[model samples]
Target: MPATADFKFTASIDDSLSGSSCWSAPSNIALVKYWGKKENQIPANPSISFTLNQCKTITGIDFQPKKNTGQFSFDFLFEGQPKESFHPKIESFFQRIFPYCPYLSHFHFSIDSQNTFPHSSGIASSASGMAALSVNLMDLERQSNPSMSEEYFWQKASFLARLGSGSACRSLKGQVVVWGEHATIQGSTDLYGVEFPDEIHSNFNHYQDTILLVDKGEKQVSSTVGHDLMHNHPYATRRFEQAHDNLKAMQNVLTTGDLEQFIQLTESEALTLHAMMMTSMPYFILMKPNTLEIINKIWSFRRETKIPLCFTLDAGANVHVLYPENDKAAVLQFIQSELVGYCQKEQYICDEIGNGALKIQR
Candidate 1:
């Protein structure tokens, strides 16, 4: 098969993409949309995410023939502890995609990854881990089969990452990643997300995302359960349509470079996502009193200071503040005060919009 867009490097996977030296990939923050997924956990729509400068994961994978069953003999160590879920999840990921790389049955993979920042602190650490694993495995496959396209290799790697965590798929692409409607996303048999169309992606990278860890505590609605709630909700379609509309509006503004329109639409989308969570028939909510208070404070502060600041949140209560480059310092100060007043066990974190997956070679 011919190489896909990203996989094609104008040359075969020779000494460059080969070898098991130390490898790493960066964290990502979402810009557009990626609220749903299908089979291999691909996104329902083409969403974009920025690779971050601050947080990253360094991983080293060494493949070996084990003395065990077809299942990989796994050893995982990161953050100075053994990640208990790593082994089982990796096995499960292999079980689901056995057709693509049946050799997984014979090889044992020793993997280690650690973040430059706190783990599971609403910093999108999964994004970095997933992207790193995807690229590392793909590079391995390329060492064996030099004819693969970068796109196909990434897609396959993404499929595997999805089995570990859904958001990991977004981490496979660098600078900005677009998780589109492939089988995993569009309810088909194939895995990994489809890339966005050229027409839609042409102007996508200009928009930026800056995250603020408002609460930094744990999350109430994890991505997996949160997605399930969306499915079970009686007004699912209505909310989905609302998200769709919001995504479209945001995309239009992104293409036009309209900052005002972008902020308004993104703020609305963040609220709408939470609103959907609130109104689910049985009723579930991810926000706490502090969450709401922080939001209100942000709005109040913006109103009082007349600053061009706007805040948005992902699955967790941590708020991501979005503003132009000129206002970054002021926004950071605002977040610091809000944390001092509202949150009990939270730290103020700020990161500008980042790029997609990257291979940090040894």
Candidate 2:
């Protein structure tokens, strides 16, 4: 495990430094689910996820030297328009990561970001958005310390992204990533996410994830609030323990190509995540009537067709339908005929497993 001090930037920056970088990072769907957290953005339990392809955020940063104001100086834009509402979150992120990237105060930055998926479409943009911003900041840091190793670059990027948003760390690399400490996963830590070290069977390659947008409206309870509720949650301890065991089981399922076990574990994890939400001190339900309708349709389709398809939710009413690449044709057909009606305005996104974030060359 890497200590916090290891990430502190000790290198000198040239006063005349000015540059720009753009990065595109994908949103990931957690398989084991990270529902709770500890201090300093540490996960209460380890979780693994599939990096997505189409659902991503692209962020570009242009920075130039400025008088030292002892404060972060930046303007933020969303999809080419000023979004003052987003400023607080970005400001908080900059403050949290300033310790690791101390030169932030030395430059005035113009940051613009856009998501591929529709805004407020029930997809959480934090994972990809923060990952893109972190990598872009690292790109600037590389100019100050050109000798930085490739491994260190990604590790620090993941680390900084975690400070912004815990799940953002996992968006840095790999088709599958593991975040938080677990006995079964070597090199895993709460400080940052690590790529799955073991070889993944070809059976899991090019896996499909079709996101059905059930509610596009703002979440009644934000993920931060939901995570905080777990502080006094009745089943918090057992849920954490179950996450560890499920992660271990998922490792075997991925390696041995056990689709049956995969479906069971994946679906179970999703329901258990919502179960925690429903059973919390201040009980809440993120799932809508349509959310349950879509889920039932999937169950019936799978039972009749004998397809290895399953669903997962991410703290919202939206459902991510997962299936093998080979079963896409039939599964999508079922979605069109049955599940699409349940979505808000019949909105959905077709995405697949992706390698990871990319640096866009200008």
Candidate 3:
């Protein structure tokens, strides 16, 4: 684990520094969900996820020296439109990271962000958005300290991103990323996400994730509120233990290409995540009736056809249908025929495993 002191910027920065950075960071779907937090945005349990391709956020930041250095300053924009509603979250994020990136107070930032998927829906938009913003911040930091290594650059970026959104750490790099510490996984830590250190079987390469949008509206209970409920949750301890066990099991399944075990663990984790939510104090259900309907249809289709298809949810009504690249044609056809009707506006997104964030050259 990296000490927080390591991230503190101690060197004097020139007041004339002015530049910009843009990054496109992909959202991730957790096979082992992270439901709760401890302090400073640390996860209560270890979780691993697949970095997605099409579902992402593009963010750019322009920064220049400002006269006042007492407080942070930034202009926020979403899809080219000024959005004051987003200021609170960004303001909170800046406050959290200001200690580590203290140079922020000396500059005014123009932040423009846009997402490929719905903003508040359960598509992990926060993950991608924060990841992009963190990398852009890192880009500015690199201008001050050009000798920073590539390894340290991404590690610190993931660290900073986690402070913004826990899962955002995982969106920084790799097709598979693991966050939170597990005894068996080397280099895992609660501070940030790490690329899966072991070799992955070719059978798992380019895995398909077709997301079925059951609801596009904002969630009734924010993830922050849901995470807080776990503070006094009766099942929190057991759920945390279960996540560790399942993540261990998932590691083996990925290496051996055991699709059956993969399906079992993935689907179980999805349901268990919602179970935690439903069983929490003032319990709530993020899954709609159609969410369940889609799961059932996918199960039936897999049972009849013996395909390795399965489903997972992300704290919302949308369902992510997973399968191997070889079975894409069949699974997509089944999705179109049986599941599209259940989706709101028959909307869905076709995405696959990706190599994480990319820097856009100006």
Candidate 4:
């Protein structure tokens, strides 16, 4: 039996909920490169993302649909927009995806979304967006599979969410998440997001990351395009190895509390990781002037003030400063007054390493 709603979208529901349950998933920054996925968007190997402290998305779902094919009908309220976009991509997803995932097709969604940070600041909003969507979508799943565990639901959701955005799979959980090694380069890879163990969570508490709004310009070589470059890259294997090694080393440092080692490995890995993209035949340069400037400043900080600020980049110009949380105060001031300089005031997103991703209300 399906329940239909005319107020939002009319569709079928086995049972009607009192209302809607809310969930929020925090945004994350890749301390290491999670680039280059295989077909179906699986990654070459496992990589991780840190659920950020600052950025996140909240979504609420009251699942009653306007139609009865048991299809995926969604009405989205994107952040701050006067009206819901009902973005074309989403509509198309319902039209196409419902056939395979029949349950989705029947229900229509009344989705409300808001971003804690700027939409396109290279902060990986898609990660949180899809995460929130999937988690919130679970309400529909739960209606039927009341016995299904939350973990199981999230695993399944991550798998589906990846088809929407690559980085999104990681946003299904908090603290730390990995798309695993099964993914292709563009994040198009199909891999379930896994939460880290409590020990790993405890170990990462002191880690620091600062998002630098470099040049604050457009993102070149969007993650998807970057993956395409990776597919055709001659040194793809080497780059993959580099990313894997970096991830392993990062995990070790977090586990062992090795700050110095973490800094050294992180900077080298970021350069080499992006270099693989730079040298690609089709050249994808996502780094803005401030990206390089911040890099140089970090280096100079090491030489002049003797700071231990290491840097990492994802698919965009925004640079993340990875350092020790204890040193965070000085880290923020140093970047604001010294490294960032007054010149680049136009582009500055000073924030520390944030917590892992989680649903908003849930």
Rank by TM-score, highest first.
2, 3, 4, 1
Candidate 2 lDDT tens digits, 231-326: 999999999999999999999998899999999999999999999999998999999999999999899988999999999999999999999999
Q: TM-score, each model?
A: 0.81, 0.99, 0.98, 0.84
TM-score: which candidate is best? 2
Clashes of each: 13, 0, 0, 43
- Clashes, model 1: 13
Q: What would the per-residue lDDT of candidate 1 be over residues 1-362, giving only the tens digit for each residue?
A: 22223332333223222236455666665555456555556555445445555667887787765555445566788866898877776667666555555555556677878887777666667667766776787777777677776666767777667666766766665454555433222322224444433233333343334454555656766777767666667776665565556555654565566766766876776777677677765557776677788778878988897776676767667666666666666766777766446654555555655555566655
Compared with the true structure, the alpha-carbon lDDT of candidate 4 equals 0.65
Residue ranges of candidate 4 with Cα displaced over 4 Å: 1-18, 80-86, 92-100, 182-190, 201-203, 342-347, 350-362
Could you tell me the lDDT of residue 57 within candidate 3?
Answer: 97
For model 4, residues 228-288, the per-residue Cα lDDT tens digits are 7777789988777777677767767767767678778767767877787789988877777
Query: Relative to the true structure, how large is the alpha-carbon lDDT of every model?
Result: 0.61, 0.94, 0.92, 0.65
Q: Give the TM-score of candidate 3.
A: 0.98
Residue 140 displacement in candidate 4 (angstroms): 2.2
Q: Rank the candidate models, highest lDDT first.
A: 2, 3, 4, 1
